[model samples]
Target chain A: MRIGVVHETAAGERRVALIPQEVDGLRKAGHEVLVETGAGVAAGFPDAAYAERGAVIASATDVLGAEVVLFVRAPGSDPTLADALLAWLRPGQVTVGLADPLGAPAAAAALATAGITSFALDLLPRITRAQAMDVLSSQATLAGYKAALLAASRLNKIFPMLTTAAGTLPPARALVIGAGVAGLQAIATCKRLGAVVSAYDVRPAAREQAESVGATFVDLGLDAADAETTGGYAAALGEDFYRRQREALGKVVAASDIVITTAQVQGVRAPILVTAEMVHAMAPGSVVVDLAAAQGGNCELSEPDTEVDVDGVTLLAPTNLPATVPAHASRLYAKNLTNFLKLLIVDGAVRLDLDDPIIADTLVTHDGEVVAPRVRERLGLA
Target chain B: MRIGVVHETAAGERRVALIPQEVDGLRKAGHEVLVETGAGVAAGFPDAAYAERGAVIASATDVLGAEVVLFVRAPGSDPTLADALLAWLRPGQVTVGLADPLGAPAAAAALATAGITSFALDLLPRITRAQAMDVLSSQATLAGYKAALLAASRLNKIFPMLTTAAGTLPPARALVIGAGVAGLQAIATCKRLGAVVSAYDVRPAAREQAESVGATFVDLGLDAADAETTGGYAAALGEDFYRRQREALGKVVAASDIVITTAQVQGVRAPILVTAEMVHAMAPGSVVVDLAAAQGGNCELSEPDTEVDVDGVTLLAPTNLPATVPAHASRLYAKNLTNFLKLLIVDGAVRLDLDDPIIADTLVTHDGEVVAPRVRERLGLA
Candidate 1:
C-alpha cells in the first residue's frame, strides 16, 4: 500500500496528518509512504525529519493521487477547493479523514460521484475496540488542556496558592461544567494546577467520572431525567429545564474565579448555560472560557474567536484551540489515524469488511454510493 | 496622621497603594484614611468596598493635599504631569512610594525644592528587619509566576508528559537564569507544572536556592569570584566574563523548549544572555520569555512589550508583568507597604529620626535638601 500525506490548507490550521514517527511505523510494516513538501513544517516536523524516518518527499500533485490519501481535514470540506480535490481521485482510491460529514453531508455525495471510498473518522463508533482510533477523543484532550492554559494566562491572579516572606495567598476557585472527554481533561488539568475544582453534569454517572479527576461534584438539585442521549452525548433539554439549571447555577458561578463550560449536543446548537446575569454576578478579574463557542457558546456573552470584557470579567471564546498547540495535537491525531490505517489496510491491499460494525459505521461513501446510514439519511438520499 | 491614597497616573499601571483589607488595620491604628475615588477600581476593589472598611472616599485633590500621600508609582515619574502633581503638595508634607530617584535624581531635587520629605521604597535595605517590607521581592514573585504561565501558554506543546490512549508525550524542557526571588519562583512554578527545569546564576550560593526550588543547578564552568554586591544583588561583571558566560550557555539555551531570563543588575543596563544566533538554533515552536525586558532584556533579540519570532522561535519581552496580574500584585504590595508604615509611624505623628538606618537609607529628600548619598552623588549635588 502506498499512503499519501499532504499539507493542511485551512486557515489557522497548523497540524499535519502524519508525523515522522507514524511514517516510520508504516515503513516498518512494509508500506511505502509519500509526504508532500513542507507538510509537517508548522508542526515542528520538517521535510528532512520525515526523510530521516524513511519517507519519500514528493509534490502535492503526486501525493494526492496515491492509492491511499490521508489528511487531518477532508479536502472536499472546503468548497473553494472541493472540485479540484475531487478531480484528483479516481475509482477504487480511498480518502480517510474528518470531512465534516454531519454538517455537510453533500460532500459525501460529491465523493461518491467521483468514485472514492471515504471513511470519515468523525463517525467512528464508541466501541471498546475502536478506542485507539478515536480522533475526536484524542483531539478533545488537547483542546481541554489548551482551554485551561488559556484561561490561566488571561486571569488576573495566580492559580496556585503560596505562603512566602510577604504573606499567604488563597488558591483560585475553578468550576468545570460538563463531564465528557474534554470536560474530564479540563478538570484534571485545573486540579494539576492546584486550583480548588468543582464540576457539574446532567448525567448522574458523570459525578463519579468528575470526582475521579479530583473535582468535587456540584449537585444543582434539579432532576435531569434523560439528560443523556443514546449516542454518548448530552441531549438538549427544553427551555424550562435550562432556565431552572441556570438559576440554580448562578451562585456557584459567582463564587468561582475561573469557569470552563464544555457542554454541547452533536449537530445542535449548544445550550446557553451561563446567562448574562450570572456573568455580572461574578467578581471582577474573573475569567470564563467557553469551549463550546464554535457550536454557539454555552455562555451568552461569548463570541467566536473574540475576547470580550463583560464588566471587568474576561470572556474568552477561542475557536479551534487544538490548532494553537499543533505539535502535540498533530502527534496524537496522527497516532489515531495510523491505528485506523493499520486496521483497514492489511498486507498492501485494502480490506473493506462490510459486515464489520466499525467499517459499516465509519464508511460514509463506498463504490459510487452514500454508504453510511446516518449520513445518507441526513443528505435526504435514503 | 492622615494618610491619603490616590490612583496611579502612570500609563498601564493598575496596582493601588492600599487595599481595603490593609486599610482596616490602618484605621484601627488611629490613622485617618482618605482614598481618592476609584483608586482601587483597577485592582478589583470599588470605592464602596473601601468605604465599608472605614476609608473616607474623597476627590484626588483632597487626597493629594492630605498630611501624607501614598502612591504605587512616583507622581514625578511622568514628566508631563510632574509639575502639576508637585504643585498640589505643601511644604513639610511627606510622600511615600517608588520614585525612581536613582535613575532620575533631578526628580529628587524638585521634590526637595518644595520642602517635601520623600522616601523611595526601592532604597529599602536587604536586612532581616526589612524583609517583611520588601515590595520588590513581593512583586518579583508575581512576575516569575506570570512568566512561567506566559511561557506555558505560548508554547505549542503540553508542559506535562502524559501516556494516553493515543501515545505518550514527553514533558517540556525549561531553563531559568538568575536564581533570585523571580528566578526561584519561576523554577518552582515550572516544576509544579511538571516540566524538566534547570537554572543557572553567577553567585555560587544560588545553587542551593535553585535546588531548593526543584531545579538542577547548571554549572557553566565560568568564574564569578565577585558576583554578589553588598546589596545582595547580582553585580555587573566585566565584558570578558559575560562573553565567556554567553558562550557556555548557548548549548543549554538551544536545547530548552522554554527559556525564562530574569537576570538584571539594578540601576544599570541588563546583560544580554541569549544572543540571536542562539535563538536561531532553537527548534520551531520553542518559547523564550524575557522577564527583565523593562530594563533592556537579558536576550539580545528582546524588545520591551514586543513579541518577536526568529526562525519560528517566539520571544516575548513583556514589561511590568506584575501589572498584568494587578489584583494579587496590589494585595501583596499593600501588605508590604502596610508593614513599612507600622515600623515608621509612632503615636500618629510624623517622626523623622535621621539616625535610624531604616530611615537614613530610604529617605531621599528632607527639609529642602537631597539626603540619600547615592542619589545626591548621581545628580552632582553632593
Candidate 2:
C-alpha cells in the first residue's frame, strides 16, 4: 500500500495529515509513503525530517497520485479545495480525513459522483474501540487547552492567587460551560493556572467528569434528563430551556474573570449560552473565549475568528484554534488517522469491512454512493 | 494631608496610582482623598466606586492642586507629560510614584528647580522595612507572570504532558534566564503550567530562589564574587564575561521550547545572554520572551514592546507587562504607595524625615535640590 500526504490548502489550516513519525509507522508496516513538499512545514515538521524517516518528499501531483491519500482536513472541508482536488481525484482512489461529512453533505455527494471512496473521520463512532481514532476528541483537547491559555493571556489580571508583601492577590474566578472534552480540558487548565474554576453542563452525567477535573459543577436546577444525544454530545435544547439556562448562568458569568464556553451540538448551530446582556454585566477586564465559534458561537456577541470588546469585556471567538497549535494538533490528528488506517488496511491492502462499525460509520462515500446514513440523511439522499 | 490620585499620562500605561480600596484606606486614616475623574477607569474602577469609598471626584486641575499627588508613572517617566505637568506643579507640592529618576536624571533636576519635592519609588532601598513599599518587586512579579502566560499562549504546543490514546505528549522544556523576582515568578508560572522549567542566573544565590519555585538551576561555571551589587541586583558584567556566558548558554537555549530572559542590571543595559545564533538553533516552534527588552533586551533579536519572528521562533519583548494587567497592577502599586505614604505623612502633615533611609533614598528632589546622591551623581550635579 502506498500512502500520500498533501499540504493543507484551506486558509489557516496548518495541520498535516501524517507527520514523519506516523510515516515511519506506515513504512515499517511494509508501506510506501510520499509527502508533498513542505506539507508539514507549518506544523513544525520539515521535509528533511520526513525524508529521514524513509518517506519520499514528492511534488503535490506526485504525492496525490499515490493509492491512498490522507489529510488533516479532506478537500470537502473547504469547497474551493474540494473542486481543485476533485479534478485530480481518480475513481477507486481512497481518501480519508475529516471532510465535515454532516456539515457539508453535498461534498460527500460530489465524492460519490466522482467514484471516490472517502472516509470522513468526523463520523467516527464514539465507542471505546474507536476512541483512538476520534479526531474530534483529540482536537477538542487542544482547543480547550488553548482556550484557557487565550483567556488568561487576554485578561487584564493574573489567574493565580499571590501572597506577596504588597498583599494577598486573590485568584481569578473562571467558569467553563459544557463539560465535554474541550470544556473539561479548559477547566483543568484554568485550575492548573491556579484559577478557581466552576463548570456547567446540561447533561447531569457530566457532573462527575467535571468534578474529577477539579471544577465545582454548578447545578442550574434545570431538568436535562434528555440533554445528551446517543453520540454522547449535548443535544440542542429548545429556546425556552436555553433562555432559562442563560438567566441562571448570567450571575455566574458576571462574577467570573474568565469564561470559556464550549457548548457545541454536533451538526447544528451551537446554542447561545452566553448572551450579550450577560457579557455586558461582566466586570471590566473580564475575558470570554467561545470554543463553539465555528458553529456560530456559544456567546451571542462572538464573531467567528474575531475578538470583540463589549463594555470592557473581551470576547474572543477563534474558529480554528487547532491551527494555532498546529504542531501538537497535527501530531495527535496523524496518530488518530494511523490508528484508523489499521482497520481500513488489511494485510497491507485496502479492504473495507462494513461489519465493523468503526469502518462502516466513517465510510462517508463508498462505491459511487453516499454510504454513511447520517450524511445521506443530511443531504436528503435517503 | 490631601492625597490626590491622577490618571497615568504615559502612553500604554493603564494602571492607576490608586484604586477605590486604597482610597478607602486614606479616608479611614483621616486624610482627604481627591481623585481626577476617570483616573481609575482604565484600571476597572469607576468614578462611582471611588466616590463610594469617600473619595471626591474632581477635575485634573483640582486633583493636581492637592498637597500630595500620586501617579503610576510620574511626569518624569514621560518627557511630554513631564513638560505639561511641570507647568501646573507648584513649589512645596509633594509628588510620588515611579518617576524613573535614574533613567531620566534631568527630570529630577527639573523637579528640584521647581521645588516640587518629588519621591521616585524606583529608588527604594532593598531593606526589610521598605518591603511593602517596593514598587519594583510588585511590578516585576506581574511582569514575570505575564511573560510565562504569553510564552505558553504563543507556543505551538501544550505545556503539560498527556498520555492520551493519540500517544504521550512530553512536557515543553522552558529555560528562564536571571532568577530575580521577575525570573523566579516566570519559573513558578511555567512550572504551574506543567512545563519542565530550568533557570540560569549569574548570581549563585539565585539558585536557591529558582529551586524554591520548582526550577532546576543551571550552573554555567562562571566565577564572579562581585556579581551582585549592594542593592542585591545583578551587577554590570563586561563584554568579555557576557560573550563567555552567551557561549555557555547556547546549548540550553537551543534545547528549550520556551526561553524567558529577565536578566537586567540597575542603571545599565541588560546583558545579551541569548544570541541570534543560539535562537536560530532552537526548534521551529520555540518561543523566547525578553522581560529585559525595555533595558535593551537579554536576547539579541528582541525589540522592546514588539513581537518578532525569527526562523519560526517567536520573540516577544513586552516593555510594560504590568500595564497590560492593570487592575491588579494598580492594586499592588497603590498598596506600595500607601505603605510609603505612612512614612511621608506624619501627624496629618508632609514631614520629610531625612534620617529615615526609606524616606531619604526614594526622595529624588527636595527643597529645590536633587538631594538623592545617586540622582545627583547620574545628573553630574556633584
Considering every candidate listed, which one attains the maximal TM-score? Answer: 2
Model 2 misplaced stretches (Cα beyond 4 Å): none
Tell how far residue A86 is off in model 2, in angstroms: 1.3
**Candidate number with greatest DockQ:** 2
Model 1 Cα lDDT, one tens digit per residue, A91-209: 88998987768767888889998899999898887888888888888888888888888878877788889776778989889999988988998888888777899999988879999
lDDT of each: 0.87, 0.91
**Winning candidate number (lDDT):** 2
Q: Which DockQ values do the candidates obtain, in the order shown?
A: 0.73, 0.84
lDDT of 2 by residue, B63-109 (tens): 89889999888866765666678788899999998888888888889
* TM-score against native, each model: 0.95, 0.98
TM-score of the second chain in each model? 0.97, 0.98
Error of model 2, residue B93, in angstroms? 1.6
**lDDT per residue as tens, model 2, A310-335:** 97899999988888888999999999
Q: Evaluate candidate 2 and give its CAPRI docking class based on DockQ.
A: high
